[model samples]
Target chain A: MDKNMVTNARELTNTEFFYGHKACAGCGGSLAVRLALKVLGQNSFVSLPPNCMSAVGFLFPQISFVTNAIIAPFAANAAVLSGIEAGAKALGLKDHHVVGFAGDGGTADIGIQALSGAIDRGDRIIYICYDNEAYMNTGIQQSGLTPYGARTTTSPAGKNLPGSIKMKKNMFEIVAAHGISYAATASIGYPEDYLKKVSKAAQCESTSYIHVMAPCCTGWGFPGERTIEIAKEAVDCGLWFLAEYENEKFTLNRKPSSFSPVKEYLMKQGRFRHLGDDDISIIERHRDHKWEKMLKNWDS
Target chain B: MDRPKVVKYKEPERAEDYPVGATFKAGHLVQTNSGWRTFRPIIDQDKCIKCLRCFLVCPDGAIDKSGESLEIDYDFCKGCGVCAHECKVGAIRMVKEGADEDGR
Candidate 1:
């Protein structure tokens, strides 16, 4: 680890790389981008897709990013990062980092192919997916990363259905399958852990990807003040896990002895309020299955 | 490529006056966002532990920690109350926007 690693909040830079945007109050995605940019520093070349961060940060006549940044197309965030990396290298730029901030819809649904190609080509870029679980910028619509039983504008809860019937795509494992240089799963609730991952990604010589679970207060139907609390509860309840893949091995950073009740976490969010006991059981069963596989194969 | 000139925003009278590609300087505070806030966070300096948790968690970067005492930049704070909610010692309180003597 480098001496510049931010192990605590006080060590973080006072210089705000992201600020003065129109993001909703207590927006987790914006916070994630802000904190990651702090870790990456001012020399970072940031590429954001047409997600909440870009929509809110790149307002015309009032741009937010202090570092050099541009808005990439929704499906070309990774490709743009790759281009930035190659262009910087050609220009003989030193001590510069090429990073991308894409949302779940941009990463898992639209930008996944471009991301895969970048990793396959061994491009030296950092791709951070601030997964808010759905397409929050364009209203609350379900995406491929939306969890099962969560109510979205498109996937409503009613007598016949229990919201989204599909589970979130395993983005971390999928990225790791490419034998990328570095990959990690993070959450805004655990800022320190997420910061460490961002730092590690910046240090990678080749492509690196970090999938961070950022909770959205407006989309999730929760009080703005409760964003951090709800994000922590999600991980504590076993819905999200912190892990990293390096050197062709997976390591779990946190292994809770026992998980908190899933119902308490679900009932707090408006999206999951309509879920029944059967739906809750199904979610728990899936969580247990995932844990069983991870505990058996992954190193803790 | 050379760094683009930082042009101040102005009402465009003609198309030729606009900056190339409509580029704006990064991190330029275009306008104050205080109007968006319904509540304001007031920090009790005596009770604050200076943990810097609130500083790191602020989405708007409204909390200023560079001075001897932490200051809340009301111009940009949207008053989400996350800092007050995350305060371990209840040092930060969210007051309704117009309830105070300042009437703001």
Candidate 2:
């Protein structure tokens, strides 16, 4: 581990590696990309799929990444990252990192196969999934990572059915299960922790993954400025968590002594505005069940 | 394949003036996003603690902290108010765009 890791906002690089893109106001995905790029420095090669980051980043005649970056196919973000790593190695490049920033839909749903393949091959690359909980760029569609009670365009809240019945996929654990060199769950709300994870991923010799929960203001139905606040609340309320996997071990980071009210967290979002008490309880129950298993199996 | 060049933004007089491929220079500020902003964040230097919280939280990378005091680049800032919202010391305030300098 780097002794002088950047643990504070003051220690972050002053350079703006990501800028002038057309991301929506307070877009959490863009913040994740910007912060990660700052940590990776100018030598990094970024691969983004057809997610919000790419849509708003790679606009014609206005590329956002200062470093070498490309738009990979929807399901090929990790694959492109592997190729970039191989090319960099072939060219004898040093002090460079190949990284991919995919959205939740791209990671947990579409790009899982290629990501798994990259891990299986032990490719030296960093895969970051900035999960805003759905296919936010494509008009708020239901995705594999969408929470059970969140409403979306496809999963409409009606008189009978709750929004989405499927819980968010355990992407961090899924990647860790492949025996990855490093894997962590983060949130844009916790910038220091997220920055440290990116720095760690850059230092890893083999496949590394970080799944960051980024709140989508437009899609999630919250004030744009409240994105970071809501993201923090999610972790504090036990809906999202911060953890890391390494050396065949799982470590829980920042375990809350007692979770804040999950209803308060969910009610702030427009997508959950229609969620009834029963739905909230179901979500809370699921969270408690997951935490019980995590506390028993992981090191806190 | 040619080495990518830093092509500056210019109005194309003819179709031939366009770049050869679907490519652009990295990190080029091709366009300013000030038009999208409805409100702008003004930093109160007296109250600012230099915590760099606003700089780190600005999604657009519009906050400039290279100087002695933080500055917001109005050209690219979308006026989302995240900086003002995140500032813990009550150093930043969101003012309506096009308002008087005194925040009338």
Identify the runs in model 1 with alpha carbons over 4 angstroms from their true place. B1-8, B101-104
Candidate 2, residue A22: how far the Cα is off, in Å: 0.7
lDDT of 1 by residue, A1-300 (tens): 688677668888877888778899989999999999989998999999899999988777788889999988889999999999999999999999999999999999999999999999999999999999999999989999999999999998899999999999998999999999899999888889999999999889999999998999999999999888988998999999999999999999999999999999999999999999999999999999999999999999
Candidate 2 residue-wise lDDT, A1-300, digit = tens: 576477778888778888888888989999999999988888889999999999987877788788888999999999999999999999999999899999999999999999999999999999999999999998999999999988999999898889998898888889999999999999999999999988888889999999999999999999999988999999999999999999999999989999999999998999999988999999999999999999999999
What's model 1's lDDT at B12? Answer: 69
Question: For each model in turn, which proportion of the native inter-chain contacts is also found?
Answer: 0.73, 0.79
Task: Provide DockQ values for all models, in the order shown.
Answer: 0.49, 0.51
RMSD of 2: 3.1
* RMSD, every candidate, angstroms: 3.1, 3.1
Candidate 1 local distance difference test against the native: 0.90
TM-score of each: 0.96, 0.96
Docking class of 1: acceptable
Q: Tell me which residue pairs clash in candidate 1.
A: none
- Candidate 2 error regions (>4 Å): A1-4, B1-8, B12-16
